[model samples]
Target: MDRVWEAELRLPTPLVELRDPLFGTCRVLLKRDDLIHPDVPGNKWRKLKYLVRDARDRGADTLLTFGGARSNHVRAVAALGERLGFRTVGVIRGEERPTNPGLRRAQERGMTLHYLDRATYRRKSDPDVLAALHDRFGGAYVVPEGGTTPLAFPGLAELVNEFDRPYDAVVCAVGTGGTLAGIAAALPAGRRAIGISVLRGAWSLDAEVAALHRSVLGHPLDNWTIDHRFHCGGFARRDARLDTFLARFGDRHGWAPDPVYVGKALLGLSVLTGAGEFDGETVVAIVSGPGAG
Candidate 1:
């Protein structure tokens, strides 16, 4: 929400070395996007810049958005709204259980939390459902779940500036496809954007991202593909292997991965590079985890 964003708003995210599994032959690097900001860090910050601008430009005083109970998007929107002078509302999916840290932070940031059952949450964008929210909130601007709207790309595309040169390929964990879409939107020539699905199910991520790209750029972009190998058995579903990998990764690299997004993408990077997937000298994984991890 700073006036500086009115310009190009190019960020300088750190790119750190993750591992040299092939004795420095096949090197893997981590794009430390999580360090981009404190309250609204990583991909969350990248996805919201233009969205916040759009809300303000429309003369909207209240910003309404959707996410899960523990969604980073919800917390980021709440924090940004509070700091930027916009009233925020969060449409949380699933029933509210006991105290959740993310939701608590959103509440502390003054976001009005509305809990919806799974069924209703799935239909959040339906006309009837949206109409209900409009009637109740009196015309607050709605940011889709995961902030994956057309407005998200401009901010996300700016993230491309963080990389001076393209690696063999750039990878990001996909939630609602906004992060991936933005990366693919500004994909430099000769570089590929790899979308690693962090959530399971039959939802066609390619189809969704294609639709989003078309809406924003007038056509779908090439040089991007989806990798379904890294969900770790669906969103938020952790097991012994994932836990062990996360622990070992943090212990070795000294950077703890957010169990939700960056951890899964890191696991995928290990798999792809170990199998000798790409022919480039360097591969980059956009790590939205804390600091170096």
Candidate 2:
């Protein structure tokens, strides 16, 4: 598996300058983690690398995880399973959609799809719900929604270490808060990380990132903060402002970022820059890639 990872995955993903008028005085660079792989791109690769290893170490032959129908995490897990020869099961939230591209890709990659109602999915962490899954799957190793776990931090830390230049701050779109927590935990002494939340009204994201830090690093660090004002609407929801920004961004940059995560983060950064928040600072925005489909 290690050999496969080393041979197949792109390490030290390219860092390139992002010249945008919206950034004003900020020197913005894009950490192109999105280019890490055709499948399992960006933070998905970072978060899952170790969890899969841990599953193997624990003698588990199957990987079980939770995600929405269009979840990038689900597609990444299925891709990893295909690459590494592990049985994969994706417990999807809401009704199954046979035509959903992401779910269909996972199915093609040999992932068993299981659908759960929204209410039951909310209780996925409950022991009873987990036990029921275990009974059906027979002792599969379970990865949480968005693949955020203590085991995931180590791989995420490597992302920070791969930076080839100095910067005042690093930024990424916050979904489960794992990517931000992991990056912030590994940042150098003076640098900081800012997370742009993609979930509307996600006031608890700061607390969640802090708890993740405490879980893995033994204490929470103060080098990180989250911005909840730019969700556009909610997860997978996009409004006219975001759509306009994405269109302009794609026209200028020659790449179209998915509205769900990367687009939202860049839009937030642009707003922050316009407000003089990142004036005269160097910011590296992580292009975590478009989620499945």
Candidate 3:
């Protein structure tokens, strides 16, 4: 079995137009990675690519990964694995609830879901926990939560090639910081890369971002930075205004915005663009996943 399943997709051309006149100052283009794969979509699909390959190369029949109560990564990976005939397992953080929709969906998709207490889940980054999972799962390949690794970044870097016009800035939401890191590494010099934080108490993501640059790009990013002001009380936080914005934007552009990634990215982009952050230049915001459709 091939580790990485190449998702069939039509990579979008340059300059995604904004239907909102409010964002007219700067031209916004979207690398429609959302269209990358039907099942495993967008940056998640790319990040999972080499990891899946590595898993297969290691002779693993099962794929194990970690995620939150409502992780897009979980949704994508479970569906991808089931479609590809690999037994899938999701080590989900937080208590298993009778009403968790994402978990239910994952289970319905045939993924073995393991619910872990927050204390144990918090230690997911530690090698000991990973080793334990490996031991229990009998050598199942473990992909770090969100598949954020050096291998993942290189695939995301290829997104830079799809844009024709030189961009003044590129913005994306940071979860594990993989997507932004890859884009920053691949973007041309003088272009600014801004990461909008999505995880609360995620102060250490900058180090992850920097490390990705060094490892994937073979250099360091001194100019790129992150904005943590509007994580909106952490991941999965909701506001009526965000819903309205997402609905309106999607209606105009015929795109869907999932609450986790693209929703926050659009939220930050709205604020930053309104603040004249892109007043004198063109900006490209990576639309990481497909809209509600």
Candidate 4:
């Protein structure tokens, strides 16, 4: 397989200072992973790096992954497949909408999109469902939803290794918990990583992240934590308070984070900082990317 696509990615993405009253007394820096690639950005790129290599090593010409209609993971997979000369299949949850921008972009990148009803999507990992998909797609390499498998950890770990300055903590929004798991696994003693969950009522995210840690390193590390209070209703749902914050953020910073992930993360950081959690510490916030759709 050609390795040309690797050269196009911006590794060790720039870290820039973020000044705002929301962060209270803490000095914050933004890790601009969003600039890594136009199509495959941030943790999406990180998660896919090794999975693509694994697919190639197995002599697979097709990569099939699961996600919702607007998933960044699906879009990234499609873009990666186009760049690397592999066939891509996106097994999407819910009804198909041909007009959806993300899915349309994926299709333009030569991905075959297949939709599964919500109930069937819930069983996406079941043996029977997977077997049927394999039969339909003809031996494609499978990547799970959000690309959270063990193969993804190494790539995410590299993100932490690329930090150029000292920091007391690193923070990011959690969708699948893979990014948190990877960062937590790589952090040296004393420093910590915090995740702001984007899914409401996702109380089990901590366990899920720990399980991911165990999958990658044989044990769960303790230098990380997740804050579930800042999801702003739930995944893909935002209320007036969040909207107002984002508007103010945009006016001050010249860019507004997407409501689904990064915005929620910054909000959590704001609340946490105000509550004296990071009173005098320097923090780095991972700017993952704008939402997929």
Candidate 5:
């Protein structure tokens, strides 16, 4: 608890223009959440802010969290723990190898890595599993995968308030549904939100978002929709089309996006805008992470 994290470190990021000729008067802007902070950036950090504060308020010494091998959420938690002064334990989805980038970075950040098979990982929030972890790691705070807890909604809602002007729509890639819900909940009247799902055949993300939105904001939200056409196979799965788009986008903009999330999202945004779904209206797409490679 010796390190000082300035309250003002939660800097507001700028929005960038993503040019495409066909859109004509319609503008495509990118909210640069990926640049929020070097170590704890994007929705990953936005989603963790309140959770970390709550954990410290409850006198938690360690934050135990769950995620897949390449989860940005796990990386954010570990990095936050180190930078903000807290112990961390990462319950990884598989028996991840030491070379995995996310796992390696988490370990470097002083987060203890715990492995469980796929089946066990699915039951991560199970009372028995949580109890076992508590028994082993003491009274640590637990952050669900993707930091989807109710407390996180407030931090994410802050992102929506960043716009000085109204946008017709805001878009982001959805993993655990928390980010989408937060954006939708905080949007002013007349604006909308969209989520390009990066996962397929898992639990219903829409249901999860709906439930979380209701839990946090006390009502159902009707201002957003989910587009699943960009999964590109599944979470962390890629295809040639997505790869080609990523390469071309990077070449054009000098920004390489991770295939898992940001790439698909930009592609979806391009498609939707080009198709006139958002023509003549100001649109904003979220760049949620710095591409890993």
Candidate 6:
């Protein structure tokens, strides 16, 4: 429990006030999870909170996790590890790049960086990769990519504590389904939870959400749902429309969105609402990260 805890932060990015004449009427409210920390920001920080505490409790001197070369999770974990007095090791996908920003930041923050090919990185979710990592790191505590695990759920469940209003629905961009699952578990009787997946073919998100629910609450949640059509060409891919939206969003709200995560999610919500999916309900959209612009 002696590990560093990033403060719980919130910001109001204009709610459903912007209207698209062709689309329909909808309000856009942003939950600024990105501003939760200066370096290890947003939902990433929330998910890692319990993990960091557990690492300290177990007397772990080093933290090991896996992600892509430019993963926001890796960058945030590196920053958090440095602040929390823990050495970090990130098993990154793709060939090693001497000029990778995430890698350079990790190195600057004293994190040991490990590179693996895409095929090998694909094995990261397997227990074998974890075992191999443990052998190499020698007692480094392992955190899953995206800091996902049962423990991470409760921190997100606590998000309901931050809101004082009655939101008809809670929405967020789903990467691994942790945040969406957490919200479903934390749902008050009448509220709906919606997840906009950033990955294509995210049909698996439902199963993942169910697993998280079972792991955290010891039961599957029956309430929440996912809308998978808005991935916008999957992670890191963007177009002019999204770019214009991001620019306008920043100009209007004074917040930045990384094209990979929040931008896609935000754009997805707009598309969904414009299609009359969110017709007449008050919704809270969780802006999970300010990972990159």
Q: What's the TM-score of each model vs. the native?
A: 0.91, 0.97, 0.87, 0.97, 0.93, 0.88
Tens digit per residue, CA lDDT, model 6, 138-176: 988888888889878767866665766656788788889
Count of clashes in candidate 6: 4
lDDT of each: 0.79, 0.91, 0.77, 0.90, 0.82, 0.76
Candidate 4 regions with alpha-carbon error over 4 angstroms: 1-3, 96-98
User: Model 4, 1-293: lDDT tens per residue?
Assistant: 35587788888899999989888899999999999998999998888888899999999999999998889999999999999989999998986544588889999999999999899999999999999999999999999999988988888889988888989999999998988888888887899999999999898889999888877788888899999899889899998889988999999999998889999999889889989999989899999987857
Among all windows of ten consecutive residues in candidate 4, which has the lowest summed lDDT? Answer: 94-103
**Global CA lDDT of candidate 3, please?**
0.77
lDDT of 3 by residue, 132-198 (tens): 8878777777788888888786577667777877778888888888888888887787888898887
| Regions of model 5 farther than 4 Å from truth | 1-3, 7-10, 22-25, 96-98, 291-293
What is the per-residue lDDT of model 5 for residues 1-293, given as tens digits with 9 covering 90 to 100?
A: 22366453546888877786645567888888888877778887788888898998888879999877767778889988988789999988776543476678889999999988888888888899889999999988988888888877788788888876668899898888888898888888989999999888645888888998778778899999999888889878898878888888778778777788888888787778778788689988888876532
Runs with alpha carbons beyond 4 Å of true place in candidate 1: 3-10, 22-24, 95-98, 289-293
The number of the candidate with the highest lDDT is: 2
Model 2's alpha-carbon lDDT is 0.91
Q: How many residue pairs clash in each candidate?
A: 0, 0, 4, 0, 0, 4
lDDT of 3 at 106: 78
